[model samples]
Target: MAKELLINGEVITVNANDEIVEAVAIENGKITAVGTTKEILQLQDEETRVTDLAERTLMPGIIESHIHTTMYGANVLAVSCKDPEIRTLAALLQKLKQHASTIPAGQWVRAWGFNETSIEEGRFPTREELDLVTDQHPVMVIRACGHLSAVNSEGLAIGGITRNTQNPEGGEIGRRADGEPDGRLIETAHMELYQLAAHTRDEMREAHRVASAHFAEKGITSIHDATGYGLQNIEALREDAMSGVIAQRVYAMVGALNKPEEVVRHYMQLDICTGEGDEHFKYGPVKMFLDGSSSGPTVWTTAPYTSDSGNYGIHYLAQEELDALFIPAHEKGWQVTAHAQGDAAIDQLLNTIEKALQLHPREDARHRIEHAGLVREDQLQRMKALGVIPTPNPTFFSEYGDGYVTNYGDRAQRMYPLASYYRNGIPATITADCPVADFNPMRGIHSAMTRKAPSGQVIGEDEQIRLLQAIRGYTLHAANASFSEKETGSIEVGKFADLVILDRSILSAEVDEILGIKTDRTIIGGETVYLRSKEPVNV
Candidate 1:
């Protein structure tokens, strides 16, 4: 392949020294040189392709450390009940009703991104309310947190759930005063119904295409798919990756939900443990959810919620159960990344991981605590000692910071302590768990640098970090989380040419203006996959 030269731009090489260069040269999909434009041009030959960046800010393509690619792709087709779209209960019903009309009667109608706090009703829409939208169609709307779902009466019937049906051990079914199902399903129950409302393989393929295009347009060249449901989801992802439908490099975490042992066994039989695939697609870790979402008020906490004095949230797994699953996987060399939001859940996760390490110690295992939303000083120290990375969504602070204050009071100050992570020398990765929040990394960067919530309140000003640190959290630190640092994180020599060009310099922009920065072009492996129409340039 001909060498490609990107010049006349600010190349923010997020390397070890955080150097800034004016140009970079790529050969065979890897960076061959980085320096001043004149220096880089010296290496160019007649066969080289030269592209002027118009002084745009060039950097490594943003890496979303935690996301659900397939699900996010599918959600693009689902009815969006997100904020500013449906902020009232009546609006939600109207939106659902409108969506139901677009689909055939008796078919399932799925929607996502519903936040109770944003609605005037200040609660999840009930079955009766959803039934008003469409009794003929089976309707289900998932909360922004992905841990809760509210379904219509038809949806409940389709799932074979009834008043007589008992709640699953790790889940709950909301009930009405008359002992009938009220349409709200939490945690495992929500997941089970979600499985029942499955999409066809063809549908998933289209979803993958849509999602890949969306990510590429947003300048995301890589993502860590936080959850892969089963072999089927994994197969679809692989097929998409191999077929080039998914342009972003994917590191999937095998979800160990429902039948944990069975899932582990299936992966083991296939001999696909961590670090099993190429850069385009790879298996990274075994993921399990130990608690629900803090925003949903279902996260397992030692203290009761401030709003509800008696409710301490839910714990999805027992210690023995966690041990039974994690130990075997750890023994087989699968790094674990468990979702633990509340402090209590964090404690449980830490204990389980400590035991697994003691039984069969693996140095630099890099077991991760996904969304360590709330942690005490002690837990931070323990995380540092265990070499466990805490991957938290800073976007949550900007998008749902008010909700955190409402749910946890002053305790919300401790949520996603980026500054503390830096102080403790804990390598952390900032992510936007898409569908839960917008996938734009700039929003996360802004939130971390300012700690300013959507309500214009600074939840924890002291916890804010520098803009450079936040950027690293999304680039170098994020790649390290997936064990891909050696291959593609920064704009380093010999690294994959996964790079993005921004319209503005985020480094010098005002904190508030950071979110306004736009992607002018996104290139992966020296291939220009997405470029602004007006700034058309050859790949």
Candidate 2:
């Protein structure tokens, strides 16, 4: 159970001539060579397990290209409305009345990353402020753009919602200027208040093992799970990645964002398709939802939104309900997607994936676009002639790049272009839709090379990129968006050693100190699940 090598490192081998190389080599778990450190230590023996890397910065591990992993592992065991720790709305109702006085009385506290523009009363916390965080409990909260939520009036009398309910056809329910039922809830009204306080199967298997050990301590080995709803989040991520309790590596896309036979006619009546499983869970692409959340105002944009006034947001399907689920899952071979972020929901998702590739002409149908979030240079030349895969989420440009230039004005310089997806040869990927941003792939590679925006504002300086194309947009265009780039993105040979060592020298940090560079080990196939402290070596 040994045989790795690693050596005095810098590796960054995001391959195809983007090489850096110093040393590499792993055995049975793949990557068996990459030169120097004296030509790979002359093929070490005696069950070699070297790993020197005193020069730190070995790459390729970090492929989140659109997440939601069981709703960020049940919002990492819920009840913390994020952002500088609940900034204000009276500190998110005093941390929801101290977590609803430690759960009891009619259960369900729920919370999750709330963001009314990182609070200070920018809004959203009333339902009489989550029933002043308790009225025999039933709170809710949500909204760090999980398509809004609010609840608590004992959650509209436990989801019998009221004020003559009605809205649900692409959702809304906010109402209150004498009509009542204002406990927010947008987009299919957050799936029946998230299936009425779900979260059980042993608390979602310890919230996907604390969201896969907090995404392998931010080195995130792999993940696609865009939360398309049913098949119960791909059967609890293929039974928590087949019992090793999910320590990364998963694709899991399935569908159902409000019925269509709960995940496309029940997975086109099984027999598996799209990329299928094994290698710690696979089977992705089939998901839906055609707009909303590019720093919320509810996306679907084709103009109007200089911060509201006649807002052209909210589209939510009806291209015949997204060609009744992405054209027969793109002609029954699978690999299709949605959750677009407005270019009028990426033009109704490129006119239903160009009419399902002109009535089925499939062939590497990468069919993604999850969050192109406002792209439009002729929709990036028709998503580079329909090969379409642009996962895009560069830390949503450092957490909502100044409310994306005050709500899509000047179209926030074609948001999420990532240097126009590497100047047109688009394989572009990069994500972190975590509990809504902060999955930390070095702050999505320094917000794709400083498209900066924590007030020192630089939101989309011509869509900045480069720094190994923002580290191959989270490692090899996020493993070509789950076709798994010949199995696990870079430092390539036979792939999957699934690297990432880093402590410094991401080619000389300082793009706002690359998310304060850290992570000291997070392998995967070649084990070492996550270390966090290991440096000081010489030989």
TM-score of 1: 0.96
Reference-based lDDT, residue 460, model 1: 83
lDDT of 1 by residue, 410-511 (tens): 889979999999898888999988979988878888888888787899988888999879878988898999888988889988899999989877667888
Candidate 1 local Cα displacement, residue 251, angstroms: 0.6
The total of clashing pairs for model 1 equals: 0
lDDT of 2 by residue, 78-122 (tens): 677774667888877887788778877887888777878778768
- Alpha-carbon runs more than 4 Å astray in model 1: 256-261
CA shift of 508, model 1, Å: 1.8
Each model's total of backbone clashes = 0, 1
Work out the TM-score per prediction: 0.96, 0.35
Worst 10 residues of 1 by lDDT: 256-265
